[model samples]
Target: MTTETGFTNVDHEFFHRELDAFLPDRIYDAHAHMWKRDWASFTLGADIQNVGIAEYDRAIAEIHGDRPTETLFLSFATPDHLDLIDEANAWTADQIKGRPACRGHFFITPQQDPEWVRDEVKRLGLHGLKCYHTFADCSPTWEASIPDYLPEPFVAVANDEGWTITLHMVKSRAIADPDNLHWIQKYCRSYPDMQLILAHSARGFQPAHNLEGLGKLAGIDNLWFDTSANCEPIAHQAILRLIGPDRLMYGSDLPVSHARGRSLGASDSFIWLYEETPVWGEKHIRIEPVMVGLEHLRSVKWACWSERLTDQQVEDLFWNNAARLFRLDT
Candidate 1:
């Protein structure tokens, strides 16, 4: 049976059978989000409305059990709700108060003054910045270029402050696009102190793109990747093999992680299969999908197995890597 929060018997079984043994004793969630419902332009369900640090802890416990878990909380707000960015970021900062092991990122838009953003991040005591393509001034944001949304002025502030920027890049070809590679290399090379984290396995939902592009991104020490809700094994496997596990950290992608579905790599693209997707059954057989978080963990397990990573290396993927990046005492 599934709970109101979306955890189900299927997820429990999947976790115990496939993930319990593979997970480390401590987990550092490098990516997750928190916000108030009123701050969003879109309607949020009562279950997810007003999600704060406490609520996040409760939701994650369904998957993490009693194991100690810390998070790098991201501020959440859609493009239409730009007016609420300050409140949303304030909420995130408040949620992480007193939780030294945890950190938060200020949500940024391209139009904001760079000086204001830098001062705001310091005022909120946030560690980094989070930028999305939806805020870009483009017709179809999915295909927007890096600088279209994440302006250089903001990146310069991050570089000066030595802050991390969690970037969710967009394009039809993901990282394989020449423009994407050029911009990524430019920021990391020019801003040696600022760190750039590519979310969703470098947006490698389509593993073929990662396989084709990750090798080209080699030798950049400041570039990192987070395995956040990307269910394809090859996506994570390629990063581990080509980039090394030390530069890869774990990210739950929270609310999405609780969703019941998985992302499948299609021909040069990817598709998300939800619980209501009609392809789950055929003839007399039925397929029951677990939570995306569980599927994500399973994918990590498969990738580690394929890469023959040691237990310590696996721990680094789950915890140590992020700890070292955030300068958290272990």
Candidate 2:
């Protein structure tokens, strides 16, 4: 093992019994989306899930080896589809009713008035709201603002309710300034009360993109970031360093990538991920020691893939903080 971070030959078997308990009693996958039967839910990548709610449950059981006591669902829609807010919100809320750990987020857009969303939010037991930052659409309420299309009313409701929101957070030609995340901040400065979750660890703490903004986020108290789709090293570390533990949450953009992705392939992916389960508590690394490392292991073959953190830190990122943040009853 190299001294740098303790080298290990990691493969997909990296996801076994060790991670089985990292979540303690349970957890909340802070950033996730469910595609309804009407339209296949899609993340930014080429990956698409023809499967709907059931698939998410299977992912919680097999991949996480634990069901999320709650999952904050993001609306995976482009600008054109933003008007269907109520339908999308209802679909996710129904899924939540079916699963204990499920909650919905409105990908609020200015394309329509925020009153529809405000009304919907009141009807649903929502945990957060999502804003599409790259939208090129006209607001029914106000002028276009950074972080894209959210109109004044949507932000107003979020600011009033003390609810959490995640900006689409993709660095874009339209959104050249990450500090527009500051837009949420700018408004919150006046409200001094609303909460917002910047997605993708604010594009992985890129200095030009968002680190400064993340650093500044601490001042807002209401602004926080989620590690959704951010399993890479620099992103995690930057967040751990800047935002600290309480604000972070576990989010695997699952089915977005093979629930198990190994350069090797499906079978190897599983074998490599769950390698520790087959043996007794003693092995090359010792089951107990590596078991401590399990959550880190399951967090994506970080050993060979990326060594930005230690096994214990991963355990914290993967489940502990999530449990705390969501106040998962489990």
Candidate 3:
């Protein structure tokens, strides 16, 4: 029952039954990616090679239907493609220009000069910064400290400009890790103007990390989170209950959204089950996995339901919160 677009009959049914009525009419995707295929050092499928505004619109429609969508488009570049960083960031700026509702973030590396980074962001008209752990000069970069990639200098510039930073932090224990907590606290406390968005529910693929650490992060006014590609109900539920819905935003994590799989919390960590994952089923029955986007929507619905959030609160997660943060016209 898989369609030409990669969604299946199961996906449609899940959407209509579990998500259609629950979703608001407007959406502001707070953490989607945009990149050129050729710029990638690794291989990209033809379907996602040219993921600019147009491709993003079509991809989001598959999940959001006819809802009008705005986005915070993150420029995509990996450590392998560091040489093309400027070109990739410029392309992001070009794609989002003239689209007032949308905004873009300049991809930055730790090695770049802080002054140059600030000027480049201003020149490109980008609203903020997007950084990843891969750029850290450490073996097994997953465990690298936050400062290794997103350095203090870059943060100072963001604070000066009142820019937002979408950070996908990595460590074995995620937000609960002592080093992660220290840097996050230092940055937000020292620079009140810079808004810090903890992407993927603070990388809470393991909900325990959120439950264990979120209590320590309370009362930070400039901190926020985006539910990007995370399918754990408790990870988001914890945020709603602890941080309030005003600080939580919905993110499709597109391209990954198009993939057929769901991320699951396993023991102290988490694992992703993809279409090719052999554990989809056993001898008793078979299962057809839906799109990750559908699974993510369902998770958000469950979190809202568990927290008994009002419709207005739900709207805030999907749209209003982002609008308020970006100062976009509603």
Candidate 4:
């Protein structure tokens, strides 16, 4: 099941067989990350350590083969390393400087100054801002009563610049949580000019959560959702049925999602290139390296195909939507 291309699972083959092709003309990856090796100690785990620009590009090429693809790079969310927000943002700026196909989103801590964020975005030519309220143990706890992570100043700056905000929601129930829903509604109404992208269908890992959340937010025109790290079929079905393809964008959530192989429809940890799964065959059967990021890419492709989307819809999800949102076409 392993190939020299760095994929472990047969899913990629399955995708090709099902779709009658293994590659698309182009892939506008809406979500991806890169980090400095020195920041390893600050990372949440060893699997994510040593992930930098080179590794990120390798993962993308390994997944899509020779097909052309573009990446929108977001800094790795480091809750414990909030002090490194400026440094992380700067690092991303440096990584994408000459890479025309790549765009970077700077990270903003809850305590960051709005003027500073606005200044930094202009200084680094950042296309957007990323807000992570709950990603790790050091991340802020999700509560209905908590204040907006992006304060008024940051919101104002985003609106003024027409920049997108990629939000990874906090809380167990995700977008279905009453408190989160309330906040999103308020934010969308208050800042209609700002383009809001809800990561992972608002993190709707379960069917019911997807239904309730996407259904509730269907009326918000400014709100968009990205297919990043979300592999649930039912949620994707709901996304198409509820919000339509125009607002649905593609994201691989690379590096973190690519550090190892994962069992489909399971919460298992990343299996390294050298690790073996007994279920596959003999004990310690060395498994071929599988690019988990490709798993995400293939999964989204399957989602679009499953929905019986038109060619235009597929193009919109994978390319046009993200391009328009990020102003990449220009």
Please give the lDDT score at residue 277 for candidate 1: 88
Off by over 4 Å in 2: 1-12, 17-25, 41-52, 66-69, 79-85, 98-101, 138-147, 172-178, 205-213, 257-330
> Which ten contiguous residues of candidate 4 have the minimum total lDDT?
266-275
TM-score of 3: 0.96
Candidate with better lDDT, 1 vs 3:
3
lDDT (Cα, tens digit) per residue for candidate 4, span 177-287: 887887778877888888888887667655567777778888787888888776566667788889888988888776546445532333311122312544445476844
Following a full C-alpha superposition, what root-mean-square deviation does model 1 have from the true structure? 1.6
Predicted structure 4: lDDT = 0.69
For model 2, residues 1-330, the per-residue Cα lDDT tens digits are 321122133422444433444343455567777765354444322333334576666544544555544567775665455455567767777777766656567656556667767777778777657776546454431234553565556667777776667765443311235446557667667655566666655644232333344565665566566655443444555556666655666665444433222111121111233333444455556542222123433443342125455555555555665555455675
> C-alpha displacement of 12 in model 2, angstroms?
4.7
Angstrom error at residue 271, model 1: 0.5
TM-score of 1: 0.97
- List the candidate numbers ranked by TM-score, top first: 1, 3, 4, 2
> Scored by CA lDDT, what does every candidate get?
0.89, 0.53, 0.90, 0.69
Pairs of colliding residues, candidate 3: none
2 or 3: which has the higher TM-score? 3
Arrange candidates, best lDDT first: 3, 1, 4, 2
lDDT of each residue in 38-66, candidate 3, tens digit only? 66632223355677788778768889989
Model 2 lDDT vs. the true structure? 0.53
Each prediction's total of clashing residue pairs, residues at least 3 apart in sequence or on different chains, is 0, 12, 0, 1
In angstroms, how far off is 135's CA in candidate 1?
0.8
What TM-score goes with each of the models?
0.97, 0.67, 0.96, 0.82
